[model samples]
Target: MNGSIKWINGSATLSPIKFIAKIDNRLYDLNHFDRDDFNEEVLELDNLELALNLSVSLYTPISFLELSNIAKIVDDNNLDYKKVDIFALRDIRTDKNFNTILNINNFPESIRKYLTLKTLPLKSIELITTFSKSLQDFLNGFFISNISISYQKAKIFIDNIAIQKEALEGVKYIDGFEFADRKTSTHIEIDNALIAINSKIFPMSISTDDNFESGKLKISFYVDKVNSYDKFIDILNSNDKDIRTLIEFLKGHDLGL
Candidate 1:
């Protein structure tokens, strides 16, 4: 609600493609049927089977070649940037069978920086794929913010949704906490083991022939860089203690769907 740019929570249309990603509470209900639907349901439930996920969904989709070109352009313009990836369960309370797809000892510094005590399990996803938004206009705002997902390494994400819901219920409007009850669809790009191109968000709906996987994760804080980029930077630089606490609490509440 308060940021540099306006925040658009859910939508069926975006620049990259014409699909939707919706977040809601339906108890693993499927918008469709089959493996993809099951996967999406699990993702909506917080990537239970997968265990963990961390991704950045830009407004537009960017190809790997484009990323290379941008990196070159940034270099040509003398900008600072870092690319990294990590392999581990970054943030979860328990350990079921979650394991990193790669060896952490060989991870890039950019990815290793996130390694902390709480991130013992190895299962993460990262990428620099394009967003539906034009690269020139990325500063405007994000359809969705960068997100990280994890719970119990060995535990299924769906099993804990109720716990998160109960926690949210107990804290709603308490000490400045609240909940939203609306369904929305959004487009996003993720670079986990698999890459999702022209992916859309929607409520649990009819299944499609394409093997696409998506979820409805509760997201907060829409960063608006277009209108007040400086203000956004100031907010980040300020690092208000309350903001940090709020973020932690939001993560704790987990994905409401």
Candidate 2:
């Protein structure tokens, strides 16, 4: 449970609201059934479903739920879940264009650039862990991409994350291979990163952003910036030579409940 858990053989996505409601109902039932068993809040569950839906509805097109299913597998199976999480990792970009990033139409022109990682189906929860680390590492390091940055206000200063400075001399995860002419670090991978915002956390992933990037880690927390199911798994194994597998956790393994 502490190490990597490869749950899916291919990519999949879950409805966040359903997930939230499911877990919420699960937690409520857990307490309701055991109210007489323990009076000390034996299982702590946070009701962030309504709040998140408020925040989420502002962004994506969410469907109306006819009803929310109650979760019982964990309780029924007697699984000990210390935490349950709601996570989101979003890359809020005004533009959605990757034509400049990688020219799939003409590979020959980009051949001079170091070849990027193969799109391996995720092997583990790396979708959440690895991707997040990569994004953090990328910004922390002096990495480059085909795209350039331009600000309406060039004078704007960044309140950057603190770094040891000395660590910069060492190689970073996103630091690409060194060529005779220069070094290359293409693509920003935010694989399997656990992200937290206040009491909420999630993987938004490639597990590579696999923040579950969209589901729960342990009832624990994680995140990646990108959103949506199809995109999540695509990025995770997008690097591994083995071809990445599994986008989100399989429902069959959700707490074994």
Worst 10 residues of 2 by lDDT: 62-71
TM-score of each: 0.14, 0.17
TM-score, candidate number 2: 0.17
- Provide the overall lDDT of each model, using Cα atoms, as 2-decimal numbers: 0.26, 0.25
Tell me, by lDDT, which candidate is best. 1
lDDT of 1 by residue, 98-128 (tens): 1122222233332232232123223322111
Stretches of candidate 1 above 4 Å error?
A: 1-102, 125-257
RMSD of each: 28.8, 27.4
Global local distance difference test of model 1: 0.26
Q: Who wins the TM-score comparison?
A: 2
What is the C-alpha lDDT profile of model 2 across 146-221, one tens digit per residue? 2232321111111111222233234353435321222222111212222212112124322222423355433322
